[model samples]
Target: MSDEGRLIAGRYRLIERIGRGGMGTVWRAEDEALGREIALKRLHAQQHLSEDELATVHERTRREARSAARIAHPNVVVVHDVLDDEGLPCIVMEYVHGTTLGALLKGGGALPPGEAARVGLGMVAALRAAHAAGVLHRDVKPGNVLLGGNGRVVLTDFGIAMATGTSTLTKTGEIIGSIDYIAPERMRGHKPGPTADLWALGATLFQSVEGRPPFRRATAMETAYAIAVDPLAPMKQAGPLEPLIEMLLAKDPDERPSAEETERALRVVASEAPGATMGTATGGTTEVAWASAVPSRATATVAATGPTTSAGATLTDSGSGSVPPTPISGGGSGSAGDGTGRPRRKRRRLLWSAAAVTLAAAAVAGGLYAVTADDGGHGRKGSGTATAPTASEPSPVPAGFRLVREKTLGVTFPVPDGWKRDGRASAEQVTYTDPSGLVGLTIGTVNPAGANPESHFQNIEANTKLNYSTYRKLRMQRTTFQGKPAAVWEFTFQGQVRAFRAIDFGFGEEGGTEYDIYLSAPEAQWDTHRPVFDTVKAGFRVG
Candidate 1:
């Protein structure tokens, strides 16, 4: 029978179906007593399930309510009640009149860096609250994030949440959650901590700015493999939010930054985003337009084979190959059928096992390669004798500036008279700072220049975006310097206490030495200090 207009428990009436997913159906319902709209999720009927399986599903539904109700935060969706109707469990929650992050991204494309940082701030806050309550939202994805019309960004859907002391409610050899967002440790069968959720947050942020998951691949198995061992795919548009995202996606959970650090980083970016307004933990202002969209409440579950071990196992989806479930065991044989009772596919036992082995091998190989690699005679800064400039004779030093030669890089540039070289100067680069330490100039080189200087700058900018918050690009373009191919990149980024602007000029031929001259100063003093870069560039010479 159609569930529309059906009243369960004689108090709440289901008015319309708002969304459906693999595990349940969500309804837009009216709380007759309170005269307010509420969202109700009812477990799907599974007549074919054995009594044990049915009971497990029922318990999971109740647990979801309990897990979410434990956290009382504005960024977390409110769970009003859980009830029984027609032998099924139904959860009543606040009816958010907004679109999901996933739907918004799908329809409108990726968000700007600042906007994404705002969204991330909300998510991390919710996560902090959940963790404080001893709740682990194992499934953190874009689909589960809601942006309310009232300028609130909320995290929803605790279907797979694991409360600290509660039983897993999962079958042996079963791993439940979104495949792409699952942490690598979880995929390897190790227990998850708060960092697991942080990893998912990273993937969500990556999608928010780049329009795709960092390690996404064609099939579930391939995606799992990539997440387990592949190098992070290059990012093109993450801007200032890239660094935190990369940190969150670290393969080792311990290596990921703590929630407090993550939130602080996100706040820095959000504060500087255009049209951004800070929001309190209770409820805050957002710049995004919310749509009337709701995501389905289904959680993807994959079954695996072998005894669960600390190392983890491989996983296989029931029938749909779209988003495969993560593995839970190292090896064994099992058959998973599409819920249809048709023939099941034999489990691939060696999938994750092989991936783990390959990962270890690659790591070792990479270490060995780094140790054996040759670095051309550009030894440590003080280890070698200085080489004189080769391109041209010294030009007259401008007033208030002095000619400085970097022996290691065989380059000369004009430095403001009061600047001093920093102690951390190395063979590859040297940095000099003005008396206030708010301004700096660095001269560096690349042994084998890339195909072009502009592309090289772009590559460096990608990493810079990850490292610096509130990083804003002014210009990156190709030009000529002394008749050699060169590029200039300019941008501003947030420093410890203030914002700083920077400009870099690099030039050389492919496979030859490339020289880089960079300058940075406090944004407020940029205009006053800008002329220093011009004077230095005019006098810069390379051998």
Candidate 2:
């Protein structure tokens, strides 16, 4: 019978069925009391299951609501209330106006690398929030991801999520997840952890950019085998995301990059995405890409032989009732080693030199410029003399520019009219970011200046190189600023999704206060944005 127009809990009146998955049916409903629309999920009835099994399902439904409730993040869907109606559990969720990433991919072949990175950033943000709350989103496939019309990429459906310290709902030796997205370790019956979710995210990203899952076979059993034993299918269009995806899909969880590193990498890529902006309300047919309900498939269940050692044979069950041990192969493309005997962890560093070369070529072709302090209109390269008015003596703000005086940092500088102060500013430093969030200008102070500014920058560069796989130095040299010992350091590094160029000018006397003026922007647009740095430098003043 149709449940249309039915009132549940004497409050929610069902409007229409929006989605149906294995576990439940979601309805667009009106909360008459609250006067707002909500999504209500009614647990699917399994009449054939025993009483005990039914109770387990009920408990899992409750846990799903609880698991999602624990996390309060913008990227995660909001769970409002849980109600018991006619002995079945119904969950009320914030109705999102958008479509699933799966639906978008199905309708549109594949997203461009930059656009895919933009979506990946939202997904990673949701995952990070979940992990921080000790929750594991075991089922993180594209179908469960909601793209809201307001430009919010949300991760929904915590139906199979497992919070830390929670007991397993499924029986021993049984795996519950989409076969194609299952992590290799999970396929081997190892205890799934945060890395397992990351593995699924990698697979999701692969599909987003490549238009198909990494592993797809004729049958579920064969797909399982591919995930656990087969080499990763070669990628054709992953672009900058290829290396990160390869590392995330490594069979060994230890080989995967941490969530923090993944976010940084994704941000770098998303920064370069054309027309990439979150939280903007879109309309018309384009709204379909942001929000709409898509059918959710039930997670498949497969029986495994038993837990095996990391080096032991993997056991999988074929639907024909045969259980066989799949011997672990050595040095496949999917293995932790990148086919060259070098561990995948070290491969990211190799990208640094190559990216550096590309950035250098682009800069040269684009006529890269540098920030220079005015010196009687003599355009000597890397001029460090300060001619701008001091903080005590303010000068006229140039057209299309605004002078910002920061008392905490004891400095004043001119920034583009549209740039706004970043919330990350603190007592130590102040930063203003462009509207696009890609470029930034920062003014900071060092209480005790170092013996030499150049040496201090070199020390900092050493650490930056270690953390950033694509860090490349253009120059680090000693100079004079306002008759004070100073240094100018310039370099380029790959952000989570794109390349960026940065320059820093530090000037001060030994044992006295040091001032730092820094600017960074997209390497591709460096030529056009480079003059902003020059403006800031020309107008920079210290007390």
Candidate 3:
């Protein structure tokens, strides 16, 4: 049984699921033998597979897990063990507590250029390590990258990774990987090399800063066509990293910068961002390559603000007064990447090959996909009707509760003495946790996408029902609180360690600003924690 509470291989106890993707469901499991927590990835029973196809997938899973296990690096997720559990292959890996890059993007749109550069550097290192180990990560996208709690970037889910000199498992004309990030060479049936991974990295970086893929379209065909034939969309937010992005994204394999050169450029970008620090870059360094001699407008802006280092390079600060120009080695004036000379025909080849390969991959595998759930309960709001409430004044605060005011969200409430906010508030979201993680309170603003409190609950429920295990809704109704339109939604769902009972109160304020107050606790202790919800609601006020 793959259900919760079932033991895999009579050793790893299945905990609640942490994530799911095209390859399998990822669970936080307990290793009974070692008394340690770990992550378990179990193969999914794909609906499109036959008996033979299932066998092929199983073999591929085993091989890929073993291959990934051979790679050892801090930026790479460590694979602990591989086991056959009830005919399904399961991989045991280190349990990481954090969110994926995709989740971070969805929660707060595009990231700042410096932050994106930091993230890109980590992925580049992971790719470097895997490449050194003679492995090619066929799939490199935001969903596969993890941001750890300790501020580490980890690359995982090598389900389609191919080793060096290996025969192709994909049928003729069939390609894998996220379509938007696939290299032009791979689309043309050419064997993918390390340079291909570099191209995907460039695409990932582009999406990170621009809030969307460089070649996104309404349909697969159109998107593939765009990737192959169209010029890259102009980047307004890339800042100092535009030159690096252009160089990595060169259509021809030989034209693209090496991994070493790419890492150096990304590090320079990360290092130059205000208040941004560079992460550790492993492996040997490569000589810096110049994409252009004249600085682009964005590059000049970055150079005007900070010092940069490269081999035999010089920086002339144009008196922007941000920072004194300090040249380290090989550093020179910034330049436009695409402005450098390169044959335009390579882009055309890339375009046609990408279209052909994308069509074949879509037809055969139904397309490569990854499903990521937002972990922090930061959901969007829905639309509804407004009704005035009958009450105005709030009830007395429960004894021992203290009022805490959030000036940013312009509201305040009584928090239990022991409950404390997790870190200072930023982005208008504040979370308070009890001594245990099992119970917590979250208050934040949802996108006022024409959503009223009641309809918003329903829209969120639809998504939760699809992802949460055994999710049961008890009540979701429109009501009034503190003379404002409000909705209350209460439900129960299974978490990684226990069943949770949650209650949310969403209040609509003027200018379509919606505030949500949510509290969740272990279901077994719902009664004990229920009073806190009332305490918060009675004292809740909008300023």
Compare the candidates by TM-score and give the number of the best one.
Answer: 2
Q: Where in model 3 is the C-alpha error above 4 Å?
A: 279-543
How many clashes in each structure? 7, 15, 15
TM-scores, all candidates, are 0.54, 0.54, 0.53
Reference-based lDDT, residue 57, model 1: 88
Residues 79-195, model 2: lDDT tens digits = 999989899999999999988899998853688888888888889999999999999999999898899998889998888889999998987546787877888766655578898
Compared with the true structure, what per-residue lDDT tens digits does model 3 show for residues 133-178?
A: 9999888988889999888999998888988776657765566778
Error of 2 at 325 (Å): 9.5
Q: List runs of model 1 lying over 4 Å from the truth.
A: 279-543
lDDT of each: 0.63, 0.64, 0.60
TM-score of 3: 0.53
Worst lDDT window (10 residues) for model 1?
A: 365-374
Candidate 2 backbone overlaps, count: 15
Ranking by lDDT: 2, 1, 3
Query: Using lDDT as the measure, which candidate wins?
Result: 2
